[model samples]
Each structure stands twice: as structure tokens, then as C-alpha cells.
Target: MATDPVTDWATDFDHTDDRWAADPFPIWDDLRSACPVARTERYGGAWLPTTHADVTAIANDSEHFTSRSVIVSGHRPPVELAPAGIAPPISADPPFHAASRRMLLPVFSPQRIAELEPSTRAYCNELLDGVRGRDVVDAAVDYAQHIPVRVIARMLGLPDEDGDRFRGFVEGVIEAVADPREERIETFLGLLHYLSPYIEARQADPQDDVISLLLASDIDGEPLDPLMVVRTIGLLLIAGIDTTWSAIGASIWHLAATPADRRRLVDEPALIPTAIEELLRAYAPVTMARLVKQDVTLAGCPMEAEDWVLLPFPAANRDPAFFDRADEVLLDRSPNRHAAFGLGMHRCAGSHLARMELRVALEEWLRAFPDFSLADGDAVRWSGGQVRGPRTPPVRVAP
Candidate 1:
């Protein structure tokens, strides 16, 4: 049954409210119950669809919903994406989206990830070893944040030494509000410049790196435009970093707090897979946006062309309608079809890599410190907008 959205205060849903961003579950739970299809006039007028069914339906309906503008805050009227009219294949609609995905499929394939696992495990151990002797360490910065950037760097044939620079650019891209508009532009340009040489070199002399693979890949019987190649590389570099970082941080935050879950994962090693899935479901970090392509009714809400919808997958993962005891993180829960990575065509292409990093990361970390908890009197600080995660979750590592 359709209902008119509570228009008065609904538009004022403050995504930037610091207290709410730290723990948004209560607010989202209330909205899902009272006004699931709430409209927010902020971010140039957007509708936040915060239900499992609504988000899933909208994501799958590519004809009615366009992926052109996938962020709530940055979308403007006429629905524009960065580098105007140029979007990475991740946010592009089919058949080009499908084509771009095909190009990336082999790189993240299960077989390829298996080959990369030994190096990933070794890197995970190295990160932990560096923090082994510290009395207290920032779980987010010292450990979680470093792994993804280094891994992505290795795959792209970029110098692992420059992982810090890549991290800075990724932090900027996900938190657009945190930076001034011009700063965002500079970050984008800086990244484009950093990746330009690789693209050019790959075209001339192919190698095993992802840039080379993308250069060799074709679109509709023709090589992708130089601009597309550059944008795709930029997307991979930026998009690859913080997403898994957030998941890893959130998982450890829980483990540090929940003694039972930590011990179970340590003792019953077989439970790690389901535990990882539960962690992802409970702490899914990324929220994507879509431009309403045309007039369409979704979950009884009338969506017009040019209207923007914020698909909060994190909220969907916690929907009680879909899962039993939705709020609890049940490590062994079966039939867990969560939207942590997202749904449909725009689902994360780097999911395999993320899973491997998370599993190896947890395995290695738990092995290093058999017991750990959040540092006393140290409150976890989180960042909101686009992608959200703990920026500083200090932990008291035990011997």
C-alpha cells in the first residue's frame, strides 16, 4: 500500500549529524518503521530508500534507475557524475556496465584470488608484526587502513611504498563534504595524473598489472577511450581502498568488544567464514546512490526522473523483515544473503579480494593477539558520508 511520505521533517534527515552517524541504527530503524521512503531535501534533493526490499528492487531496475550519480550529497539536477558524462564501469549502466565488468572479471576471479592469497596472508602477518610490541595501537590506522591500499597497489604494479599517498586520495573521494570543492577537484586531478603514465605505458608495453589488463581489454569490438581507461583506473585505485578497510575495522571493533565471538572464532576456526559474513552484514560500510531515470513507482513511492535515491545497504543488512534477530551478529547464521557488498549489477567487483583480505586479516590478527579489547577511556571516532568507518579505534592489545 502506498503512503504519502512524511514531508515536513522527513526532508531534514541530517546525514551529517555527528552523533547519528556514529550509531545510525536507531534512527534508520525508526524511519523504516514510520517513513521508509523518506525524502531529504538536502544534497540537492534526494530520497533515502532505507528498506531491504525497496533498495534491492531499485538496484535491480536499471531501466528506471540510473547509476549515473551514485552519491546522495554530490548529485545535482539533470543527474551528473564526475568528469561529466564519464563514469567508471562500476557506476555505468548496461550494456557498457556489463562490458566493463567483463574486463574486470578475470582479474578478481576466484582462481586469481587463490593465486594472490599467499602474498595477502604474508602481508597481513607483516602488518600485525609491525604493531606487535605496541602497548596500544589504532586498529583503524595502524592496521585495517593499510592492508587494502597495499594489496591494490601490488595488483596495479604501483610501488607499495606509495600506498600512503593512495590512502590520502581515497579518503578524499569517499568523504566529499570533508574537503572543500576545489580540494576534491585537486585530488581527482592528482589521481588522474598519478595514473596517466601507467595507462600510457600499459598501452605501449603490456604487463601483468591491472592497468595493462584494462588497456588490452576492448569495448564493443574497440578499445576503450583513453578517458575511459583513465577513469576506470582512477575508480579502481580509489574505490579499492577504504571499503575493505571499513569492514575490517568494524569486524575487529566487534571482536574487541565481544569476548564470546572472539574466543569462538579463535577456538573454532571453521566458523571464520560465517563469522566474516555476519560481520559484513552487521557492519556493511558503503552506501551507493542512483539517479531515477524515469517516472517509476518503487515500494509504493512515486519516483520521478532526475530524483535521486540513496541506497543504504548497511540499513538493508539490518532489516528485521529479511533476517531473524536482525540486529544480532550471529556468526553461524545460515542462508545469510546480505547486501553488504550490494545487489544486482553494481555489486562490488572487488568482493573476492575484500573477502580474502578480511579472512586473512582476521586469521592473522587473532593469531597474533589471542585476546584484545578497546583501549580504556578511548572512544571510537567514525566518519560519515559516502563510505563510513572508524577512523580511530584504539585497542589494548594483550600478550
Candidate 2:
């Protein structure tokens, strides 16, 4: 379905619009100054909180805004899905949210993430190996997009050959936000059908994978239902791949455009970690949604019950009041408290893994192609909807 172009950003903003997909910083800056909390009639009425203060407050105050339907679309999930939303932990609220989240923490712990680094690094090089001889390659497609897909597939004990299918699934779930509710539901149903076989296999033959782990996990000594396992795995597949790849692709796009930053990172390998944090701040990919639990006024906006509130973490990361030089990317900026991984209880559980993939991705890419630039700046394409990142960041490397 086609959406009308946004005539006025303040009054009628659509996150899935092209203007937003290309570059949203200026829009966010304008909103922060003019209307910190911009309301729109789109998506059955939604609110966008651009300031760090408002975004943070809304994220923490789950009582007023339920995490039930984290994605705002033409159709909202049934209210009964609350407390344990479509996806557990992330979509689950409060008491149920805590237990659901705690069960998965051990798998994503620092130690566990570190254990996966060597393999992750190996995979990075393996991807780079494919485009070694090419003069021009899409850093987003040739490299960034495949890393998390393969990693997440391995973690879930799925076939690596399913990468393309996984990307399609990610696109359907994340990028097709503005599509009709029926289409959105169909997309989810397709994913569930695709995952049904794998879920059954894991149940019959448990393995050292995330699917098996969730199957064994229980909340309050009550085993999670099969549908819950499917939903969580679906979350892992969609969230784990899309957000990390977008971050990696956007980071690569930045390094390709900014010669000074690229050269510095190439020269100072030790600065990659700090640089990655700064990159995440500047190009955070994920923007979560919340369904209003009840009527409330936040930052002067009168938000009604069931209104969709978009938590634009990228916008919050750029709020001047929250961080010094909020607009600029300082590779060595310390004490950086950016909401790249989100904020409050719903914070990303796989953050450690994301950082590791991004760091290794950059390190390996820079090591291989130390000098590269955008093949054509105009050709670069960014995905629309809640998750924003370059979909086609083509780069030209030295022959």
C-alpha cells in the first residue's frame, strides 16, 4: 500500500517515509526544538518523543505505556497479549518481563560473547574473502548483511544456506511496517510456518543452541509454551540480524564517507571499540514502539490510551542536553551514555554479541580494504520504518 508523502513533519510524520529513511537527523533536530513530542494521526495515531529526557522517561515508565505491541502498524496486537507480548522479554511487561529476560541473560553474558568472538572474526574474514578481487562491492550486502545472519543461524542451529530467506523475513517484519495490517500479519504467519519445522526438530533433538535453550527454559517453574518458543526464536532471528546489520552497514557507510575517521581508525587499531560506540551513537538502527497503557500527558503531549509511542533512540542519542557534541562523532568520546542498545528494562539482551560483530566487522574490513570510498553517494539506499540503516552502501576499493 502507498502512503501519502508527509506534507508537514510535525503534524504528519511517517517513520517509513523516504525522507525519514534517507536522513532523519534534521527532522529530529527540528522536532526537538519546535515540538519535542510530535504527534501524528498515522498508524492509528502515534507519538514521537525526540528528546533524551522524554524518551527515557517513557521507556522506564512501563505502567503508563505497555510494551505489548512494540511495533506500530495499522493493526495492533490483541490487548490480551500484554504482560507477555508477541515476543517475550522485549515485548513482555513488568513482572513477566523480568523473569522472561533473566532466563536468557546467561547465554548473552560477556564471557559467552567472548567465547564466540574468534568464530565471529573468522566469519568476518570469510565474508571479506568473497569480494577480495572486486573493484566495487556493496559493503552492506557483500559484508555487513551476512555476518549477523550467519551468526544468528549458527546460534539457533539453523542452516547457513537459509541466509537469503532470513533476510526476506527480516525485511518483511522490520521494513514493511507501514504495510496493511493484513499483510503484516501474513508476514508473521509465514515466519511462524517457516520456523515450525525447526522448532519441532529442536524439541525432538535438543542441541547446544538458543532454540533448545528456550525450549528448556521456564518462567516461574512453568515451562514456556511451544508458541512462546516460536515467538522468541522469531524475535532472535528478526531483531538479532536486522539491527546489527544496519549498525554495521551504517558504520561502514560513515567510514567510507569520512576519510579522516577512516584513516584514523586504520592507523589506530586500538580505537575501534571507542569508535564503534561513537558510530552506534551517530547511526543507531533500532527504534522501539510502545502502546499506551492508559491516558497520560508526557512532555506536554496529551497521549491517549492505546496510542503508539515511538522510542527513537537514535534521536535521543543525538539530544544535545544528554551528551556533549551530540551531533558530531568523536571516536575517543568517553563516558558516552548513548541509548544505542535502548534504555531501561527492555534494553537489548544481545548487545554484547552486537558489539563484538560490529567491532570485528570493522577491524577485518579495514585490515583488508584500508582505502575505500563510496562508489556513488547517490546510489546508497537506507531502509525505512523503525529500523534505519543503509540498505545499499556500495563502496569502491583499490584495485
- lDDT of predicted model 2: 0.93
lDDT of 2 by residue, 9-90 (tens): 8899999999999999999999999988888999899999999999999999988999987887878888999899998879
lDDT for every model?
Answer: 0.81, 0.93
- Tell me the alpha-carbon RMSD of every candidate: 4.1, 0.8
True-vs-predicted CA distance for residue 252, candidate 1, Å: 0.6
Model 1 C-alpha lDDT per residue in residues 312-353, reported as the tens digit of each score? 899899899988999999999888999989899889988999
Q: After superposition, which runs of candidate 1 have C-alpha atoms over 4 Å from their true positions? A: 1-9, 75-85, 178-180
Q: Which candidate has the highest lDDT of all? A: 2
Distance from true position, residue 194, model 1, in Å?
1.7
TM-score of each: 0.93, 0.99
The list of candidate 2 runs beyond 4 A from truth reads none
